[model samples]
Target: MTGFPGVRPRRLRALPALRDMVAETSVEARRLILPVFVGEGFTEPRPIASMPGVVQHTLDSLKRTAAEAAGAGLAGVMVFGLPETKDATGSQALAEDGVLTTALREVRAEVGDDCLVMSDVCLDEFTDHGHCGVLTESGVVDNDATLELYGEMAVLHAEAGAHVVGPSGMMDGQVGVIRSALDRAGHHDTVILAYAAKYASAFYGPFREAVNSSLQGDRRTYQQDNRNLRDALREIRLDVEEGADIIMVKPALAYLDVIAAARAICDVPIAAYNISGEYAMVEAAAANGWIDRDGAIDETLTSIRRAGADSILTYWALEYARRGATR
Candidate 1:
């Protein structure tokens, strides 16, 4: 055999400490944001059927959970409200005593300024039909009308003491509308995290269940089509132009390319949501003894971080934090 000269890449891989020293990505507890669902009128945390070990927390339980998250040094908690009532226009989304508003106030009061508080500024949770926007006279999502409602919701969230308002409704001009509303309401400091490259994905199935969504049809007409990469960039550009403090790509695992593209173009912090379906798949496989749960979770998060996400929203934040402490 001819002697090969030049390449010796395996040298670094031969040593465990060397591999750790050369690791390009790291997943830390402080870079993860836990998405918590707070439901109305529940005495105990209710397990979401689709997502194992994930729950819809009651207000009292949510307060305790938020305190625990703060103590664990998590970056933040993203709150989702499962309201008792639903309407065509999702009017409860802007009510002062609304489920989400109440949860936000309680969480903020409990955690004080120690942890960042973010609220989902979308109407799907409050809508009867489980769409993210208001219906037109002809019974379709009216984009402009939805932006108006989103603007109102942003201000409400800001007033409820949310440090950040995440607009995930996928409405055109939503970031601009929300930014304007917050500024006018003297909440200029409230950050806007736009779900810029969110696709019309089937991966949201578990999330729909988590929020008790009764979506009658698909949202492909409004959300970005999965096949279109250029469209995602366009959406990201628009949000950035309209003053998005941070931009995000949803269902991070499947859309690493979108996340990378957005990271390449945008100057702001990039976020990725490791959605519920992603969490469920890992948990199910682990439960069946198909994979090591902790290793799988760590690898998944590290992969997302390596794909250029500055922060990640995950259901595994608490578990990961607990595990990290022992390590």
Candidate 2:
């Protein structure tokens, strides 16, 4: 064989140590945040049908799960609530004894500051209509009225000891409203992780089932359209300007490009949500013996990190962390 004249990329590939040393991306337990669901009125964990392995956990189980995640050295746990009751105003969302608020307090007590506790600060779980905010007389989402509710929710979460409040509703000026509310409530140190580029994706199907969502229609009117890249960028920029401590793009796999772009433009950490449908697809395929479950998870998460996500929120976070510990 003729000698290569200008390039010799094979030399680095020939040595495993050299390849490892030069790896462009890596995923670690500390960079992964597990999303957990805690429900009121459930004495045991209730399985979510659409998401085979996921469950709506009772308060006791939720505390244990939070402790386990902290012991595993995972980044944190993002808690979602399923209230026992729902109404037009989502009254329970701001109540101190509400499902999420109570769960936050319990998880914080169990973990004892060992891990970060994040709360999902949206009204969908408590709202009868299953929209992210309160509705007007005409059944339209009232943006200004919703902002006031979001602000109240933020204060409630802060009081409940949430380390971070994830505003995933995609409401206009939500970050500013929540920030001001937290500051006024003497929670100035609390962080805001904005769902800056959340798209109205079909990938959230399993999530809806997990929270027992009764959504009457799609959220396309408020959530970013999947086809609009520029809009995503603009939203991210606006959130950053509005005091978001962390920025996120939901449904990580399909929107890696958006994650990369946001990473390039923003100074704050970028997070990607490896959403429910993504996890369900892997579980379904693995059950069918079409792929190695652990291998598929590692590859999928590695790709998201390589695409510039600083942290990832995934249902597989604990499993992946345990695997990494074994290795």
Question: Residue by residue across 102-209, what tens digits does model 2's lDDT show?
Answer: 999999999977889999989999999999999989998898899999999999988999999999999999999999999999999999999999999989999999
Native-referenced Cα lDDT, model 2: 0.93
The TM-score values for the models, in the order shown, are 0.97, 0.97
Residue pair clashes in candidate 1:
none
Off by over 4 Å in 2: none
List the pairs of residues colliding in candidate 2.
Answer: none
lDDT of 1 by residue, 1-327 (tens): 356966788999998899999988888888999999999887889999989989999999999989999999899999999999999999889899999999999999999888899999999999999999999888799999999999999999898899999999899999999999999999989999999999998888899889999798889888999899999999999999999999999989999999888888888999999999899899999999999998999989998999999999999998888889997
The window of 10 residues in a row where model 2 has the poorest summed lDDT is 1-10
